[model samples]
Target: MSREPNQRLAALMAEAGASNKGLAKRVRETGLRHGRRVGTTHVTVQRWLNGGGIQPETASLVAEALSSKLQRRITPTDLGFPTAASSPVAVAPSYATSLPDTLDVLDRLAQQSLDDEQSSGVLLPESEVNSAVLSWLISHPDTLRVDVPAQRRVGMRDVAAIRTAGQMFMRLDFLYGGGHGHKALRHYFRQEVLPLLSASYSAKVGNALFGAATEISQLLGWTAYDTGNHALANRYLLSTLRLTKAIDDRMMGARILSNMSHQANYLGQISRATQLARAATEGGKGRATPRAMAMYAAHEARALSSAQDHTSAARAMNEAEKHLERADSAEDPDWLSYVDEAELVGEFCHCFRDLGRGPESLRYAERAVALTDPQYARTLGFCRMVLAQSQLLNGELEAAVTTAGLAVEGGDALQSARFQRYVSDFQRDVSSHAGVPAVQAFNTKVRDALADLDDE
Candidate 1:
């Protein structure tokens, strides 16, 4: 697809009064200071202004160069480049220590994300994902107390409000898809939650606040991922990890890691996804309930399947089922209430499909669809697509077309980019059978449904 010019970058350069030659010279000079050879020229700067992205390393150096000249922290995102190329704009001292520092980072990121000019279509690099997973794994418990001075004192009610907001947003995301409510969630965080973080509180209250914030942040990340903003999602997940670690909330941290693994898997970084899934399991050890463990194991199985390691993937799936058998809803965290048999079966359908086990995939997909709540329109839609794909793989072309039509019907009720992509994928999968009358009718229904969605 042809990309529009990076007018944001051009505007920044114009505002800074930096000519292409000047910026190019600054980049080379900055690269020299970092002991790297940069071959940037005026033409290179021109291309960047024209929507051509630079290498991640180059983007980092360019941000630094601009920061020096502008006397501020100018991130690659601010320059309209994909954030995957940039190191986090603001990182805490360490994930293991300092709640104040971590909160500061969160505040900055939340603010940046709220900006009207924030770039889109940014992805998180595989290397960044691996780095974040490693950080989470080695992070230790903080012993220091948080005692920030503020005009008002935080109470349990304040903490409860944040938690309640998180839960509310989570429900909205679950039923309607993340794109429906993520912006409002972010607004609530910036307006309501961030103030709580800054308020005066005892160590106990601070810990509670951080824990609640972690949950909300992770949800924001998941929503971003669901809506196809992978780079922002990665940053939010990392922030969630740091906040959870600061409060010594390993279970939440593990959940956040699992969420990251899902994003990585979708992005085709199967190896990184596996690493993150393993990290989630390790982090949750001794704390997470069996339900949580089952979720983690299922995510790992999906990652392994993506890597084409069918033997290991099957073993992981078996392990996931074992954990699921031991799960009790009463013993699990509220966050894990969604990880029931249907969810597990949905994941298994994905895992088996990725492993080329068509019959197994079809069976699990059918079970998932049958068990899925009607309110979960997006999930049901995706499961139907999975079922249709399996049907096609099993040489049931007529059944596949019928299932795809049902999938489109389910998908038409949602506003998720991810769901739309799933529908598109199913469309491509059944393209070979387009000559079939059912297939043609299904395609027409999907096209009209998608057009309606676009209009909305």
Candidate 2:
């Protein structure tokens, strides 16, 4: 029914010097922006070259994906389909709704997420409409309509679909990781989403898209961070920060910027960290939820720690504490409840450790360890690791070794290379004290774990 998917894919392949597998990886990344999980295996990218028609509905995704990576525009018809609109004459109406409604939808979706991982039924009123979008997001990135063309009626339905795709992109990128399939995402953001955002985001649709993109971009940055692609992560963060104005989703932008501060601190860009954190603090000046204020303060403290500004860091930590007390008073931001007291304490412990204030670090670390609820397993693991590291340096090798084991156990459930890197760092620290029996045992456990992973 459709012509060949597009000449652009083949042409673009030539430009990027991408092999079949590379292209496959890119496709998976782009598909993720729409909440699909495509991989870099042979079958998926191969299907496209063979003219194995894709579902028509996913053409936008394909178009977005190709356009972004090649640094050029791509079309749906270029991918072997009719355009998103039928006949090109009967087009969907431009949706320019209020910003508040868009955010309300986002808020509602996040609330529903607590109950369901693959969340839905919160954004749209029509069950059928929400369900269709849901199916699109979770499906394989390449498994969509190149042949079975379907015309979508634009309205609440289209908005819901877009939001759903955006959310899926954010969540999956965080869970499995952004590096797993990122080229595709980079392309989609550059092409499909950018143009749409540029054309006319209603206060309504614009805010939603802005918020969604901000979240997704942060996830992309996280992937960059994890994979040690600092330049790429910084560039993405800069780009997303530019979108903060038009987006009107203050909380999302602030949190993302705070994340940038985190990355900057990690990369030892202390001035940049200070700027970003301070800016985020300024951005959310009036509406300070405990989470938001704490996030901002955490950023500031991290920056100060990196600068070795202990006085300022301590002050910022105090400010963070004050702000956290207000988190319950303000409305919850989508991603920030994860930044609770335990997280604050963990951040504080890290700051103190960096400043070489061992006793204070230990105090906060113990408090952090005490706060580890089962649901917050990841945060708890990190805190314990911090305690161990500080203890090791403070001449408490036995206690450090003990806490380090708990940290490693906590990390076992995470399956992250970055997490593993932290665990490995602690292991390395423990091994330096090989004469200590507990340290030797800890070293043995980590060495064995590394070997096990290698054998796999």
Candidate 3:
């Protein structure tokens, strides 16, 4: 029931001075940093210690902790195999095929299932495999096609099933943010999903299948971004962009590019970020509502501000505000259904916070937090951190520290690398205020968390 010799676990724990809680907390935190799902705590740890079981994610975590502590190679086998599972559900391998076949597989499903599986309403005569079928599938824009007609394969699923998968991912993303959602979706991409994308399907079916892939890729991109895999995140983002173009979802495409801009700026690729933001705005074409336009402009403003171009920033800011005004007067597209008046302030405030415009940023930060959904714990956590930074810079030490503490509480409950970076940044700033009691308290807490992470 153990991977490495059981003797080592106790020895390493004693050498590192980590209690079971401390070790588990550290493992969970580090697991998150490396991209893993680690829900359940005391009970899970109890089971593992009581020779229950641990997943590959847990194995990797234990391996990481042991290697660091013992200065030697270690792996999941060192922990325990427990009858050898097929794989960790989070890191399943991938399968890819061309457009039509993938679509055909997704659109094919059984009748009267809870999954409501259905294939393309039109039957593709298996006897004739030609381009005509492909063209017809694409030209027919109706949602009537539920399952691909009459094809049977274990890997093949109905459109409804694909949609159900999408919904599942969307729900997880909503509940846990992309950080946790990415790995789950990635497993799908690696296993039953991506292989289909590798095959060649007719253009019509291909596009439909591509549409599903695009959403999955978008989620993958989002998860990677949220988990701090910048390079992989950008790769998935670009893939999503290309897929959206093939499927002609300019709105979604533009949104992905806008997000890319943020990532570029984060990585200090200022010009690239600016260019991408501009391209995103342009890509939106007439689809950009006042709100969408404003949001897009704000993304550009954020990039420009990062590059320290005040003139461009001002111009972009003005245009963004104008766009926001227009949004107030216009009917938004379905994709932009979530954006509203408060979101505008929140977006601009976020850009300002990043630009280090303390007072103005604080105003926007407060408004955004007030307007943001409580379920969006990560966003709220980042907002609180922004507010803390502003307050700290403005000499409101007590308020800053208290706000930072709240951010910590919010952060602890979620798994996000960006939030961690935000905390790290806050910690760096507070280090300069070491003499203050609030700063001291905050630093102590951060160190404790960091230490716990080290133990894992």
Candidate 4:
């Protein structure tokens, strides 16, 4: 069967005022930078412009070349290419035995993420997530050596600096939300971390460096998710998981998987969310802290509730509570310190809300709001929104309106898209009651606050 002509590509070419030969030449040069020896010529470019297709790899190179020439991002889809047919370029699998191969993959990923054109509209497929999880489960740790010569000798101090920077960014994210510091993190990763990965080091220093990288990558994924960039979040998370498995860090791997499950659930991928959460538990096995296990179970419970499996959800919720009861904060990893009882209660509130149990949701929501720290402004706002929804569900319309107004008052403090989503959901919930004076006033306040936030 013959395919239709790609009129979009022709139009783009006309807009760019690019001759076929000039475009082909530029693509070949761009391919060389990516280590791809593309054989595209004027004739091939003409064929593409005339509705004929090119190889997926060639299409990607063409998009990159055009993006550079046009001074903006260009994607294969923009050129009327079927992205589904293109096989993504495979990096060395996270389970690969070669340390250099793993570093190379990380370098490429960082570069791709920095490229605005390539990063935009790219989705991490469900199959990739499943495959990564499977590999993490089955792969054995490689005997790593870091003997390669480099511009500088990396040391323990460098590793500590990375960890310290990660902690700082984590605190910033928690206080102000991911959107507050994600770009700066990305910049630091590209400028500082990427070079360190290539520096010469002993086996001990190399292990520590990779460990810090893994942690930083996980944080990066979390911030991306907070900003509603799920595809980028998934990529960073999968990268982190591979690094953790490579180092035989089961606890960290479990944490990464738990985060992945959260992002999956948020995107309405309930099945994948459940699978990832189960994998987190399995990966942790005997290695994870009680607190970590509780976090994993809490995520599973939320997914189950979202899937409307009330029986399983309740069971998972109980399991989470039991584990949390046994959790000792002093004995847990610093990363897992944030998963306290209050956080678990908040998760329970979310699960019950999803299950349409309004009273349970309200009870937990109130407790979570009281337990949450004042520094966590975004979380407080979110909890308030949850409380408002529960009130509305229970037919306490006036109380709901008042709680929602408080949510709006705090909205300006958060930079999270997730928080904005909660605000939007609250708006929708009260839309039917717009005839009520309180509802109308609440709606007006929320709209004005959102507009102010946008302006800032």
Best by TM-score: 4
TM-scores, in order shown?
0.77, 0.61, 0.61, 0.78
The C-alpha RMSD in Å for every predicted model, in order, reads 10.4, 14.6, 18.5, 10.9
Q: For candidate 1, list the clashing residue pairs, or say none.
A: none
Q: Rate the local accuracy (lDDT) of all candidates.
A: 0.77, 0.59, 0.61, 0.78
Residue pairs clashing, model 4:
none
When summed lDDT is taken over every stretch of 10 residues in candidate 2, the lowest stretch is 88-97
- The 10-residue segment with the lowest total lDDT in model 4: 90-99
- Cα lDDT tens digits, model 1, 329-432, are 43865677788899999999998888888999999999998999977777888898889888888989899889878877765344777887877888888787
- Using lDDT as the measure, the top candidate is 4
Across 1-456, the per-residue lDDT of candidate 2 in tens digits comes to 754654555665666677778766766775664467754455665676666655543554555556565433355555555544132211111111222212212222222211233331221122332232233223332111111111321234445655566556555544444444455555555444443432333345544555565655566556565555554455444444444444344566567667777876776667767877876787667645667878788879988988999899989999999888877877874656467887888889989988988888899889988986655554566678889888877889888889888776553423455656667788776666678788778777776766775575
Give per-residue lDDT, candidate 4, residue 416.
85
Better of 1 and 4 by TM-score: 4
lDDT of 4 at 394: 92
lDDT string for model 3 (53-82, tens) is 566556656655554543332344545544
> Which lDDT tens digits does candidate 4 get at residues 1-456?
876777878877887788889898988987776677888899998888778867877776776677565533355777988762235643322322234434444544554443245445555677867877888888887555477554588999999999899999988887778978887887788668866765678989978887888877788888888887776677778877777855788989998998988888888889988999889988887988888889999999988999999999999999999898889742875677678888898899999899999999999999988998867777788888888899888999999999988877876445788888887888888888879999889878877887787798
TM-score: which is higher, 1 or 2? 1
